[model samples]
Target: MATMPSSEACSMALAMAAVEKGTGDDRGMETLQYSGWRCHRKIHARRPAGGMMPAVRRVPAHGSWQRTRGVMVASQFITQLAFTLGLPFLPLYLQQLGVHDPQRAALWAGASATFSGLAMALMAPIWGRLADRVGRKAMVLRATFAGVLVVGGMALVQGPVALLALRLLQGLLTGTVSASNTLVADSVPKNKLGSSMALMQTAVFAGAAGGPLIGGVIADRFGYRWPFGATAALLLLSGLLVLLGSREEFKPQARTQPSRSERRARTRQIWLLLGPIIVVNFLDQLAGSVVGPVLPLVIAHLAGGQQSGVATLTGTILGSVAVSASIGALIAGRLTGRWPPPQVVAACAGGAAVFALLQGLASSVLLLGVFRVIMGLFIGGTLPAANVLLGNLVPPQDRGVAFGLTASATSLGFAAGPLLGALLVHVGLRAPFLLTSGLLALECLWMVWSSRRLNSASG
Candidate 1:
């Protein structure tokens, strides 16, 4: 009697044949065992012979990275400008609307931010799923246009309740950064992902640095509403560019339902990979939040009752750091080739923690501002490294969800920061900064540990 081929051998043979045929064989031979040989042949034969060859997709070239970077940067600049313009003035707006108690004003402000975060957290995953089904570019357009409408409405609203409601709406719709990240992940090659993400992050930091300064100026002169209106126009323009100028490449593929065992295995893998990323983001945000809202107050106190230039001084301190952050991002972008992302992140986080500790001890506005700039440099490097790591770890098919989870985590941190700052203020003005520095130290430890584990596994 002739010995028959084992099931595993049979599957491997079919897979090899399919691969050789180049047509319908694009699906890995791993699927043949479950689907059976005849079904596999039929499915594999339907694919064009040339389809098995790597499809040539257009991506940003090294030369064109600058131009693509410009588009994404401009979009982030306007979006952040809108976000930051409202940040300083929102408390004052609540005060004007009959919230007499300082605690209430702070509470209202915190609630508005919290609701926005909750909305973003809930909607981001849905949007990510949609982006994968549709295209990331299309999602970018949606986010931009929706931001214009929701943020513009904030200018026209009559009361704090309305403003809060509008902010909630804004969070539900405004996912431009998340979409932009998805686009970058899709377009940039793995080797170049770190630099590309860093450049994109610089746009974010630049916008954040400028937004508060511009908002303060507009609020000082034309009132708060004008800043919102200006932001609305900029957002509209950004949306139009994404909708018209950018192109997305998506290859259509037949979807198949996975077996229960396969689904469970994939879920386990995703959780294992995603868990550390989420923890890193949470710690980073928590530390940042510990100081973010209190920074302006710290500057004012350091100025010794000189409230005349508080807004300007605050804007200057924040903007100066942002400028430094942008520079750091640019430098990190270039260094991605020489240094691995985890090392860069750990080093940056360590430096940022040191700066945070220094800021806690500073007695003058100048000292605080100088330290902030240094802190910005470190913080600026973290995002790109995190993004690049995510891009490398997750498969392209699942990138949308990966990025969406990241966006949601960051938003949650953003929302939580002010509240944490507000709470810490009850103890003392400088307390939050010191606390933040401690948290960052812990985060640095985590980063180092996680990085080593990942590297060891890969090695």
Candidate 2:
């Protein structure tokens, strides 16, 4: 799956833009100037009334925010790296946890993953709404600290049952990326929101692409348990960084709750954006998850059932996809710059659909990897496109909840994906890929139709 960008990147980009503008020398600041200009122009066009925040007001805040953003990006990168380090070995881990039978191990993996997704899906929205009230920084801190505890707890668990419980708890407590994104979205100038969001997305993909390769090496040399302990330590550091380094200027919504009619109207508006974006996010993840539980096994079967280096190979495959996705995200950011988000979204969804189907038809491991890499490139673009649209669609105050709701959709898809994958495996290993491709095709069609309706309405 593609990584969500941290809020830190947005803030960092904004601060750099501020610095570049003040200097006005154009000596070696093309990147900063481009980002700043992109954000400033877009935000100004959308919100002409706000004009620009005065330089005097923008400077001091930008300085503080920039430093915090730097720390946050570092911390988030480490956190993502740590979490994915051993995640590809979950089925193997389950086997070690006493599920000796291959089918049983697969089922347990799906169940554990499903429980975590279910728990996260249920809680994410509440936490998101809470962030709006308590502040996004607070929400992120909460997720990080809780992440340390739950992931660390995984190291101590001895059985599938215990591990499943810890995974479930992990979902409930850890949404650091989402919270951070919400905070960053709120902090940056509206005009630059798209660029800021794009940068954050790229940062996430970079970390995700690199983390698994290292994690695989570590897992092979050390053991599965070491990764969990290491993950906890990283989360603790991430939490400390956020608590000490990040700053936010959150303005709580009106104290009085909205009337029922107003609430209904707001909810309706939220769905207009949420409907397609959430569906896209869900479908994308569902497609990914369908293959997630059994990919290692599939690879092993393709490699003539070589069990010795399966973990490393699994990491290699997963890492390739992430690396390709990162490249795709960069391309998507540019595409969004030129075309409407919906058009970009349609293109990405369609590409992913075609590639996912090809993956199902692959007869060899090398071909599957090739299809996966190509699919990752397409899937990676979907989020940045959909995300920018969401950022534009939702009002500033509602972003935390909006992202939270997106997270919920993601969790629900993740929850269902493994279970579906497990079921498909019973039929045949390649079946999941076909199922995924079909789902993505339907999602693509719906998104195209919806975007056209939205465009026509707005026009």
Candidate 3:
């Protein structure tokens, strides 16, 4: 439960990372040339010296992809639900484990979450690279199964160190959202990439938005440990769903591997196109996570010190934000069809900033929840817009690593945000919300400053 982010989904590591479904040499090479409601892109990889397009073979969907997509969506929903079930309650659980002081519990929560994100940041690209070698389905299985062990172990932890260790293990082993997206993108047809990915994102959002509501009731009634058992069970079920339901037609492309120097050169070029996008991804995740670990603490404060029902209130508030976020993401995706992605991103970030400020100033949990819901709606758009901009600009060939790096950047933000939130909690419960607002404002400013440059460069 390490708060091991990016939402992992919000990383949009699948931002057309899915159109990778090629039979033979097409394996993961070509991205759907996504425009509005369209396919993906390809940063051409190792073009032949004879001036030929990198031989990309498009595999027809065979009409089975939609069925496959339905299963994948179910698996993703369950996976996200399992992750969120125990997440918002981590500090509460820590308090149960003897970190009784609210600030101390928040700090412990942040520390463990920071480590989990650090582990995930370090591992995301390695996993992404490995997925290229193995089948994407295998990576998806690995990620989901890893969750079974991690969450199951979390249930048995008796102290902070044990919890921290499990969280590190969670980061090292699990990245269900990212892995699942790659596999789905690999299995679904090119034409369906946008809809499939959007559905997948919605699954993540729905689970995140609703799971806490359920977890809150469970924890309030049964104690924090029960949610762990429940989460583990749900993860196991999700893993089984993916294991049995999804099919992978990916064939590792046969190609002479590029030398390290060549790979490095490609990475540098990818970074050039990706630098602005990466910053946006990082900020988007950071802005979201800053409030994540701190929210329950804020709720506890607003209620005049934690006594009872804090988990339920916290869950309600977090759930509201997530519900709004889902709507925001859909709206953002639609608006991208009409507006420049950067403009959409700037508008969303600006709106999120205003709401976040309002959230910081709220005196009651209901008002705080209301502001957070609005902020969620706006912040939710940031990722999809940024990802659209990325998918359109980064050559499809480089996008695998490009998206991996974005995941890494997102993970780094995930790692940093909670720690920042924890430190701000020392200032006051309101400080984290204010800091989150500033981050959103800065995110908006970054988009405003770079929108024209990014668009022009892509042109």
lDDT of 3 by residue, 21-117 (tens): 3442455465432221112332323323344232232443566667667888898888888888887899999989999888888888888889999
- What TM-score against the true fold does each predicted structure earn? 0.84, 0.85, 0.85
Span of 10 residues, lowest total lDDT, candidate 3: 33-42
- Highest TM-score against the true fold, candidate: 3
List pairs with backbone clashes in candidate 2: 5-200, 39-191, 39-192, 43-191
Per-residue C-alpha lDDT of model 2 across residues 1-459, encoded as one tens digit per residue: 112224565454444333333344545233322122112321111112334422111322567666656666777777777788766678888888789877778888888889999999999999999997888899988998998889888878899999999989988888777787787777766555566566666667777776677777777888777778888888898889888888876656444477997667656755764787888878877877888888888888888987787888888878888888878887887887778888887888889999999988888988999999999888888888888777766656577789999989889889999988977788998898899898888878878888974553222
Better of 2 and 3 by TM-score: 3
Question: Which RMSD values do the candidates have, in order?
Answer: 6.8, 8.1, 7.9
Off by over 4 Å in 1: 1-70, 100-103, 456-459
* Clash count per candidate: 2, 4, 12
